[model samples]
Target: MASRLKKKCCTLYEAALEVVTSRYSFYKHDLEMLPDSVLFDVIYEVYEKGGIQPLREAFSRVDIVARLLKITDKRFCLIRSFQGALTSMFWEEVPRGTEEAVLQSQFLVEFGGGVPNSLAKGYENLCADLEDTQVQVDRLVETGLRLGGFLSDAGWFAESERILLACQEIFKWARKEGRIWLQILECCQKLLHVQSSYCHFEEADVTYNASVTTVVGLQGDFVTANLAVLYKEFSALHFNRSEYSLAHYWAVESLRAITTELPPCVIIEVFRQASKACVVKREFKRAALLAREVLCLANEVFDVNDPRYADALMDYGFFLINHDRVRQSVSIYELALDIRLAMFGPMNLHVAIAHEDLAYALYVYEYSSGRFIRAREHADKALFIMEKLLPRNHLLLASVRRVKALILEEIALDNMVHDAGTHILLQNAEELHKSALDLALRTFGERNVQTAKHFGNLGRLYQSMSRFQEAEAMHLKAIAIKENLLGSTDYEVGLSIGHLASLYNYHMKKYRKAEELYHRSLDISLKLFGESYSGLEYDYRGLIHVYHKLGDIEKVAQYTYVLNNWKIQRQLSLIQEDDPLDSVGSPLPIADVAALFFEDDLD
Candidate 1:
């Protein structure tokens, strides 16, 4: 290795010798022979003993070389210039890129492995001055953010936590050093994101409190805006934990923090989150209103063709469905589905989801219109895409299958004749409902709301099939699960109760039992959706039928009056001047009207 280095240095020396000799014709021989002179041997010995620095020092000994050669000072100066050039050539060839690589490697080691400590304390002990302290702080902040993000993306949460913790400490130092509040806020946001995402809720709470303190301490232009951001993120954290009440509280706080200067998209996002919390908390009216705001904002900010606008439209459609505006929601769902299909193409997941949304709205709308064809088509499309793309028991697939089953059941019910095609459709519907039930059991177990709904679906299907005993058992199971999971007065429990009452009144001739269940369901519906709720009609009719069975003409006439008033109010409520889909005073189809008059109730 020594000999090879020597040979390489000699080659470099000869190359410099050629350039120098060509540049200066005079003293060329003396300069060329200088390599074989005593000075050359002395310089080589210095290089061999102490390396490049010593070799460079030895090369700078121009006076000693001049004295030995007896050359003029002017010629010695020229010789010194050549010596410097040769030193630079060797210095340039030494590969200093390795040094930078080593520095980076060391920084990562300290970043990932170093103990969590105050950056101020570390800098005070190690840094020579404030300028160096500042430089260190800046480097740590910049690199920590970049590397921490990369580690997070790689799922190296532990290492990412270490780096982000170090960044937080540096941020603490920056705050004490009277750094800008915005900078500290930025660091706090990053730290909170890491903690909340990785289930570090305890640590995240501390960081959130600290961030709130920092924001409160500031008196700046973006104070409300920054608070809005913090509140929005904290709401999401609570949402991730399924703490809907707290999520709604923080979401409301975020909404309050919104300023006129805030971007439309940010406002829309906050409204969307708040609306989600509202939906989960069963605040349907508020959820629908906020969802409309999101849609309006998105429409204002984005092009109609934009996927974001489509997303907003889809969300609004969902809220509309929950708000009991199924007719309006059908149109909204159709628009969103068209946008998604046009932008994402047929096989895309968003397109499939859009189809599923439209399918759901259409399925519900078909109850009023008795139009199952379009609903079945959309349900089939969604089912086809989901079966091709998702796992067999995927949660989304289960939902789509449930919708398809309902659409098929509606079509089968429309066909009154017990022909081969009708029997086949009913069988297919039963299979789909069972398949959905199995998927729900596999994914969410028996106690879940989804599982309860599947039971209720089977109950309705059995009622349609004239399997009275099996229908009663399924309805009982559904009511029990829903009452246990969502409490007795929930909307879902009310629907199940209403269905069970229908089974009793229509098939079992248990008028007194049917009357009790119908009253209980009516109480729930009235409590949740008020007297104007269209669903109340089913329960009222069930009670009227029970009275008629008992030969109580007065009771039947009373309920008939109530049902007529309910229909009148519903028709009035359905009128909306701006929405053509509302179609004021439009009569429900014979199928739904028949349902109102002692038919099977599948609310």
Candidate 2:
């Protein structure tokens, strides 16, 4: 009976191996269909074969391996087989048993089937048994790190944090060992990144402080590299809070800490953050220089079509657009669009963003029929993709809707000028603007800057339709919000003032009111952007026209002289480039002005 049983086991093992190693097209399905006893025999046979290449290939099919683990009665042997496959696949330099145990625990946690409780209990027992062994503790820490990273990337933030914190506790016992200490520091850094990303600022700060303390305690010349990482993380934290100056300072500190031996990606990130900070600070020349460096470094380290390269291109494009280099921005945006389209296909959210950005750049660059049509096409594509992928109240959806409304408003203006389809175009533009405003208010709240801009946009649309009372109300609401959020002296407040001033001067014939508002705008603009900003021209022209209408010849002459001097300064200072607005066009979108003065970096 014993001889018969041994022969039957051998026969079953051989049959299992034949099913796994056969080149039949449906082998995975067949493997899943095998009975538990035969599957157990296959697991033992595969392990005893001493070569795990076939098992590694099988494990790569995660679903098949998962089902096999689910059905197998010899759970420990099956898990060891899976781990051996992973070791062979990754060429991991660890003991087979320790690695197997770690892999099994992680698998159970991630897959969360009937085995999780058993796996949890087993891990607890193993930890208790190895409480005094430094080697086993170190292995456990590494396992936790890998598992934590996987969970973090999967967006299981709380789970990842729990695992990492548990690992930190285990690591405390082995902290005196340099290798273990470094691993612990890495776990802390990962936890901090996860916390910061989820807006758990208080927790992130605690992690940051703890990481700083750890780095300070470590005794090594190699600590500078670690310091660089800490500084970069702090920079990201400040950047998230819109503290651009602090972000830039920390980014610069990070750069200073980096030695030549550090990877180029680290230096690239520092430059990228610094460039974005400079853009927000309105330090255009410095921002452009840093952006160019980012492009160069990214090109050297990544393919031109790589997603990182595409992001750098988009950032540079936005910087150029902010500085009024619209034509240059169009080409850069096109390159980014091509890369994103190729990488993610046309319907992806990234592709939608690229399309929307390109559309906005083109719309700002020119408002001819051709440009408007093309811009509308891009905007429509973006709206379609966003509507498909995002919730109704997503801020990104509102942004795209605002872009579409701007395009329709411009088209309405065009039709009005030509006396063609005026009523329908105006009606469409008004409704779209209202829809965008409602969406913005819902997503960003009434006092939010974006919602304020939406009100200003609708104000401009109302003015175009000869609804002066509604326009005035909208403008006043926008101004109030701007003043409340940004204070009265901010450039954004200046923009609101200028918009209201234009309404008074052109539509309401309130010359004195227009003159007052224009002067206020001029004062704010000069204080915020200096005298040479191109936007100042709008205030100067408004003031001149208002004074002229009121027959205030003296003030008109004074403003004319100021305007002439400004024109001369502009001529001397302006770099020769394609001016998208050579002729007067419709009122600029509040979104465009907002982009210029308060651009937010999209990560």
Using all chains and alpha carbons, the TM-scores for the candidates as numbered come to: 0.58, 0.61
User: Per-residue lDDT of 401-503 in model 2, one digit per residue for the tens?
Assistant: 7888788888877756665677677777777677777866664468766678889988988998899999999999999987886578766678888999999
Highest-lDDT candidate: 2
Global lDDT of each candidate: 0.66, 0.67
Candidate 1, residues 1-603, lDDT tens digits: the string is 888877654567567654543433343334435543534444433333334434333333323332333332223232223222222223354466655423322432333112112222342333233243667666556656654543343233444566667666666546454544665776676677667655566787888888889887887675566677778777877765445568889887887777767767667767777777677667776675567667656766777776667777777777777767788888888888887655544544566778888988888877866788888888888887666544456556777889998888888888768678877888998999999899778755787777889999999999988899999999999999887866788788889999999999999999899999999999988877777787888888889889999999999999999999999888877884147223223333323322332223312
Residue 478 lDDT in candidate 1: 92
Task: Supply the TM-score for candidate 1.
Answer: 0.58
Q: Give me the overall lDDT of model 1.
A: 0.66
